[model samples]
Target: MSLGGKISKDSALEPRIAAIDLFCGVGGLTRGLERAGIDVKLGVDIDSACEYPYLANNDAAFLLKSVADLEVVDLTSKLSGAEYTLLAGCAPCQPFSTYQQKSGPTDERWHLLGHFERLAGELNPDFITMENVPNLARQSVFTKFVTELEALNFHVTYGVVNCAEFGVPQQRQRLVLLASKLGPIALLRTKTKRKTVRQAIGGLPPIEAGEAYDSDPLHQASELSNLNKRRIRASVPGGTWRDWNQELVAECHKRETGKTYPGVYGRMEWDQPAPTMTTQYFGFGNGRFGHPEQDRAISLREGAILQSFPKSYKFVRKGDPIYCKTIGRLIGNAVPVKLAEAIGKSIVAHVASHSGPRKRQLNDWHD
Candidate 1:
């Protein structure tokens, strides 16, 4: 209910750079933007579950509405008092990710990016950015979105970038797009620090499978099946499923078709980055989410840490019970905080390089 930033008269005259995070799940992108020195004034998402975390960790207003339902007038007041505005988000990915089937369920999420495009076209903010699964770059909607931005005179650039290279301690790759009405804008390929799984979560105290550490509520691991318990014990760090005994091999892996899937039921290597953190990352069978030395799947907090979220980042209010399924989805779907921070830094540097006198700022906002 609290809109963190008030639209004051004097500040309105010299408005700061403000951003609205559309489809902002748990404030990942908003936090990163704030860290990169941008004032993200608002975050909007449809999920009621995301409200607590989004508001708790961010100094921004939370709007629990789908981007499809938004209009220019709806955002006029909310996005007020910004001399330079940015609209940033990663629309839901199930509709476009490789993990999701191309056909079946129908939902508004499929066209969420289209709605985002509509807002961008209508609001005409100074800058815009979107992050999503790499496959999204191959879709027609993405093509049309970029084409329309170019038509609107935006200097647009987009491509798939490896998240590990950008400071995230996971082997996740994502497509990133940056468009600016000012001048040419591109993601800064700075070759920053690359983190390993050990550097990120190695220091946390060991917790057994199905055990929740009271010291950190989010540091709870999911219960492994009796058979999975034995499977994980036999697993060596960075080893594949083939390392398991003949009786321990899954039924699917026995088939010729499933032989290629050596990535599952594996432990992470202490010196290397982890596999991509999926929504079911807390389940050992879901992916190579098992602990490097422990016998359990990586905990929810560990997954968040691999995604570059700080250890102290709050996902639920104190005294609130934790649900791994919902929290995992929020963490998996979130943009890596480090990647978002890099994107924000790129934009801020781009804008700072072209900044002119305060008197000409408003008039020079556009190309």
Candidate 2:
């Protein structure tokens, strides 16, 4: 049957596919997919912390369950009666990250990909997508995933995508895969200009270290130590600790091995895209998370903004403390929303191409 006939008459009137997001941390992928006209039915994640933001930002149910515990029956219930269904699983990438190269293969998170593969085999939805660090592409697990999908008669296409190229204001690279049972599918090449850090968060009002913006709770920075404050004051934008005075240099950096890790404890350049944000992005001592002009580390909200999350995306409620560690983990672990939007658009285009006259009729109905 064609893609259009899979829907009920009620759903055909709307003519959009339904999606279920796995590992849907804070609804980044759901938000983007919805923006591309897909109806996101539910978001699943193990962390109870994700419930607030995921439900706050998207019109979807949040299921606090690990992927291992999720049953196909539960997903099918939510996705039932849709024109087509999409399954998105962006498994955590720490196990395959470049920083974890030495210990990554041994990390338990390595098996999560295998779990996702098994789930996909069981469900076999109309379309599937996954996003992860580019380092995942080099692993044997990645090849096995592609082979399994093809074995299921899926037309698969995957590539390492640069987030900046899709309008994200961070220089993050991720492996993105899109597979379809309907027809051949590939990610659309967006010709938009790359976004810079200044364009993303330049307009926010200033706040000091250890201070929260009076207007927005998430716009708060972690407190820096007295010595770190002095180190930041001496540091230049785009420059590392190597530029700091001898007194401010960490003893670790004084060693020859540490000299090669220059990206640490550095301020981001205003005109450039930011370095990839990590779970520790709120700390001044981690990566190049320091503010360009401000003498504090990038605030929690700044990191979220860099991740392409809306400034109004609420992660905490009033009366709750906006701890740096909690909010930082949510932002850093999210898929860049803009990149997800691009993937959504690509899927829409692919389905439309295969739908032929039904798609044209739907377009005319909308117009």
TM-score (C-alpha, index-matched) for candidate 1: 0.92
lDDT of 2 by residue, 303-331 (tens): 99999988788787767877778889988
Task: Flag regions of model 2 displaced more than 4 Å.
Answer: 1-14, 104-106, 356-367
Best by lDDT: 1
Clashing pairs in 1: none
Alpha-carbon RMSD, each predicted model: 4.0, 6.4
lDDT of each: 0.85, 0.85
TM-score of each: 0.92, 0.92
Q: Give the deviation of candidate 1 from the true structure as CA RMSD.
A: 4.0
For candidate 1, give the lDDT.
0.85
